[model samples]
Target: MKTVSFLTKKLGFGLIWLLLGLGLFSCEPDPIEIDLPAHEPKLVIATQVFPAKYMVVQVSKSFSSLAGDGKEMNADTTFLKTLAVEHALVQINFNGQTETLKHVRNGFYVSRNIPQHFQQRYTLTVRDSVSGLECTAATEMLAPVNFEKLEPEVKRTEKDTTVTLHFTLADPGPERNFFLISLVGANRKNLLPKNKIGSFNAVQEQIILVNHGAFTNGKYEGKERLTLETSDTLLVSLSNISEPYYNYLQLYQKSGSLMNQLTGEPINLPTNIQNGYGFFSAHNPTAQVFKISER
Candidate 1:
């Protein structure tokens, strides 16, 4: 009876050991973590000086991604999440209240009606989503800066059947100045600071020519023209677009591999500001627009 009892205990111990081994092997391996490149999107905030109640912010996907980079990622979930503002407050009008700014979509912000005040102050308290994050950048709002004028220089070449438009120096002295242009019949609100257009400002002065993107034959077929406007000037924006008007800077121009979708990583843009789309930020600058005429 004693020997039988001992054998029973041994068998029970053996069963327990077997179960433990199976459980250990059946467990899944721990997930691996890899550091991903940051999108470093740029942010552009548009609001001209007084009664200056509203703003239009812009962001462009870098150029590298435009050429094909990420192969397995959902851009909306990852890349757009990095849109210029991290954690910040934008003061629209002088209600002395900070609760008015509403974040619209990924890159839009609107402020509800605020009590009107002359020369009212408005600014932003933004958080940078970069790894070296800086959240509180409360810019002291005073009034909108005055508008700068643009004197465009236009030239034409008979041999190449091409025309070039250039600009003389603008005297917007510091403080992040920009020139806004309207192409022909575009509305005032549709105007943007000019630098976002493709390929110009080389050699002599800031010059541009109608290209294939603007038309099938690389020349304006009366589709666009430009009108320059400024803040702190008159009550309206000087508008522009299409004598051979090309398309506006679109956010959807850059797309890459579905492989990036496989991972939750923000699609890494391969180039810096000069080569890629300048990030979506107040700092992503747009220069003045120039036009070309046939020689």
Candidate 2:
């Protein structure tokens, strides 16, 4: 009598069948599907640059769940169309020291001689002339980031150029937070460095931040490495700090509402944007020279 073995003829046949199935699976193309929900708009009230910049809040009319849709609608025409529907204004009261506000193109107020500092207490009073609503929240500019080193980094590739920034603070849990980075002209002479780059007098070049970077940690103990292509110096300030109790962007943007690009959900930004100083070094170096101070 033949004894049945684990790898007997019958079992061998079964294994061969299984191997054939796995082979088919390997040969088959992986199922690839794209899923993106509808994208709500981000109410963006922005200024070109200070000292003669136009201030306007823009609301995106449409957004896609993925980059394709977002990229398609992010053209100049769509942005201009969005700006046509909103208004914005920023009023400041430094310890009840009233300052005259003027509305520029986007309802943002600018004065010829107004300065901001972390030491100076300030309150922002905004009036939505279009909706007849007002956002008058108050917060002084917290002391700017005290970076260990803020100079530019040059490497083999232009993209390797860097600005090492570090600060002292504990992490805000593990949930990630988003930060908006921008590089604006430090002076009037250095406007629009892209079209005519490499041939201009720049006191400090701006990196021209067009988007945001989301990170999991909050505090930078010593320094962090940021890689990019820049040709100017910058005054760097980062915000949109989602702490345990404070949501900055949600506090602002009343009309169009803030949309989560990831979730495609709408949020009424409390302050919308806690405007301080120095955004990211967009793509250049000397966007804004951020001066770090200490207590």
Candidate 3:
């Protein structure tokens, strides 16, 4: 009698044939198809009306998220055509009086006789006849506030000297206020935020306010201190913005960087336009010139 092992030649051949048969019958899965709905465009308006100045309004249509890449490579001609709302009727209503704005070119509307009174409410109306879409928004201009222009305090050290400027004002009691401080003519490409201060630099050597930096009547009383390492002629503009404007800026200021968008949650900008996008705000700015010299 011959002894046979459990792994016999016939059984090994049978298992190999079974696997080959299964492999021959297997098929790759089909790709999934997704059908997205069409996107509707909304009106976008960016207008800032100030005292004793011509009202300028920029009208455009909001783009869909699924639209073509918003990048600007060989898209100069078509980009301009796509963003502008060329055939829209714009108007400004002030204290129950309406004035039609003239379309000067490329979706820019201008009005010479706009009421720019302080504490006055102005209404903006935009109508697209082809799409029968209309958008309206209201904003009130704040009265300009007075601030003290004091000399900068100089601090000397063994390595370098630091110049600090102080701006002080009596905050309007009981009412909330937003302030933006900026410096220009510094003649530097960048500014490093020193001592954990949230100061940001703009082109043309301007420094903007940061850190949800706001003041109320009780605490700061509209006092701001600016410190710089080098000395230059600084032109400062302190703007008193509305609450809605403040919220908008604060949101953007907090989450405006590309790093924040890449690593953190998405940020949606706050808009006050009814049936539209973008912000319509009125700000009162008081400008002063000063020289920051190191001692």
Candidate 4:
């Protein structure tokens, strides 16, 4: 009888151990679900000052991603028109003088005059008369970059012969410098089929263009070597950009990368506007035309 009791007790303990093992090793946790609160709308201002061009500022409001319905909203013309602020009082101050910008159409405000020189410091102020909200930003325009050499080298492959335009840029610096190299075809055609567009610059032309990339005076300060793969009649615009603009462009490039999306990284842009969201920057652009050989 004692042996039978002992065997029963051993069986009970084994079952308890098995149950405990299952509880410890085989149990799955319940997924966590967090409900985030909605976000508020903010004023967004954007502008870029370039040489020999009147300043144009775009004013708009940004909607919070969490405020809308479950369906994603597309930023169409109607949506854009709704966000546009047409009656904002925009002003620019420079050299102890202030000028009110004229509201053109949509949300764009244009200055009456062009930038005098590259070294002038300009201040931009935007006030929403309805909401009593104001935003201000400042930037100094840098001198335009001069290319030492721009020539094309042709290489014949088994499939096709390709031409690469080689560029040599000299950085004018005692201070840190940034540059943008923009290329546009005369006929408004793309250089390549799958060419990607670069970061946004407020400088716009009547014709469509493609930007190579934003470059900095890191190692190639004296004469940097750059190339563009093309065989079309291209217009190249090189601009010396302000530091804040440079920083913003760099942030944009990183945030726009596919790696950032793959890693689930938040792409929050760095804004230079005070009491607002967006950036106002200055740059000096010099353009030239390059004609490549016909294959």
Candidate 5:
């Protein structure tokens, strides 16, 4: 009787183990197949015109984010050379005159004859002979806004030094307007060693955009703070930008996320170009240089 009882318990345990193994084997997952659409490359145009400066247009081709190993896209020389649209017919038209832009180097087109006048409309036309693609865009040059007053105050501590900038500018008029404020700091000649102070050899630039209709009192006042060496030179610039270009820039900055690119999600950035995928705009910047003084 004892032997029979033991055998019965052993058989019950064996049955349970067999059922568990079968259940595990039956729960295996099946592979799923997804159908992704083919992607076609497009022409990307980037051009910013300033008064009295030659208009340089950068033309390049956009590729699928999944083309190479999943890495962030870098605009290095090799990458630019690989994706540059070369030998393209680029032209700019303004005031009943059309000027052809010369292709300087890898995807860059230049035009020195196009007059950049305030409120004058300029049209850009680009045709790629190799790809049989054509695109066009139009933009008006915006006038520069002068700064009313720019004052800097410095505060130094044992750890770091901070400079506070106070600035003001008059509004153009009741008409809607957008502005971009830029600050650049460069090392002065014969300054202290770069190691003792922070490296100021490379120009550090900070830019901020003022939204349209942000000011109502016909005047704009703002303040910015920075950390820099005592002998650094600072350049402050105020630029009046068009509404469309401002929108484009705002969207462009948002869409520059690495995760967004890696996911292959489509983002339609605001573009003035017809049948293309970039922006063409013009602005004149009023700038002033200042020498940093100890306080």
Candidate 6:
């Protein structure tokens, strides 16, 4: 009789646990619905003008982030082609003269006749015939600041050889100035005979930014050290850019990767284009090349 009582209690406890498990699994939360606001597409433009160089402008269209599948967007050639704004009228205005840019392939517009003048304001106007969207922006061409001197020191170690380039730049004046320093690597074999080093295909690049506040005594000095191989060639470029473009570059650099775009807060980059997105600016650049020794 006692054994029968024990079995009965055991079975009762088992039934109680089974019932609790079933009740827990049966409860399901209701689905949630969020009402997102409507999105409007805008025109996007990007260009940089240089003295004695042809002006080229690239135009495209922006789209809603939620319009496509929830995958990360890859800016491949095929995808970029779709975003290109075709049949657009692009023009540049300088000193009461307007030069219409000729459309090249894939939303690129070019004009070689419009000469870029330092400290002169140039206005860009872009009108898309298909979407009836127009945008205008103006920027002054900043003067090119050349490097005063570049002194390279080579340090050889058992593992590798590194070159340190010391550079100097004289401040134009007490007025505020912004500069961008770029260091890029290229293949020595890809250099065309009698061609400039800047024309070589760049493999990798690093950037250094300098603002007016960093200058002292009418001059600024900086250094960059890089480990180079035998087949590598380094190109150093200095660009004097406008303050607006400098702010734009700073915001762009702070924008995180695609994953951050999806999960974190969205960052709005600074743009000068009116009624559109993106930046239209002018800069002057001077570049020099450094060859690696085949030790």
Please list the Cα RMSD from the true structure of every candidate, rounded to 1 decimal place: 20.1, 16.6, 15.5, 14.9, 15.0, 15.1
lDDT by residue for model 5 (168-269), tens? 878878788888777777322223343263322222225656865666477778776665654578887888888887887665544433222222226666
lDDT string, candidate 2, 74-133, tens digits: 344545354332454554566556665565443244555345443455555555556444
- For 25-82, candidate 3 gives per-residue lDDT tens digits of 7864565698956646677677755456578888876544333332331145655555
lDDT of each: 0.31, 0.35, 0.60, 0.58, 0.68, 0.69
User: Candidate 1: misplaced stretches above 4 Å?
Assistant: 1-52, 57-95, 112-134, 142-149, 156-295
Off by over 4 Å in 2: 1-71, 84-90, 106-108, 112-121, 157-295
Model 3 poorest ten-residue lDDT run = 257-266
Each prediction's TM-score against the native? 0.31, 0.40, 0.63, 0.62, 0.73, 0.72
Model 6 stretches with alpha carbons more than 4 Å out: 1-29, 67-72, 151-163, 186-205, 226-231, 257-266, 293-295
Q: Give every collision pair in model 5.
A: none
What stretches of model 4 exceed 4 Å from their correct place? 1-37, 67-75, 130-132, 151-163, 185-233, 257-267, 290-295
Better of 2 and 6 by lDDT: 6
lDDT of predicted model 1: 0.31
Which residue runs of candidate 3 sit more than 4 Å off their true CA positions?
1-30, 70-81, 130-132, 150-170, 182-236, 254-267, 289-295
TM-score of 1: 0.31
Ranking of candidates on lDDT, top first: 6, 5, 3, 4, 2, 1
Model 1 worst lDDT window (10 residues):
243-252
Worst window of 10 by summed lDDT in candidate 6: 1-10
**Model 6: per-residue Cα lDDT over 103-213, one tens digit each:** 987888988887768789999999999999889999888778898987667788898776777888888888888888777673222232353433222222255678988
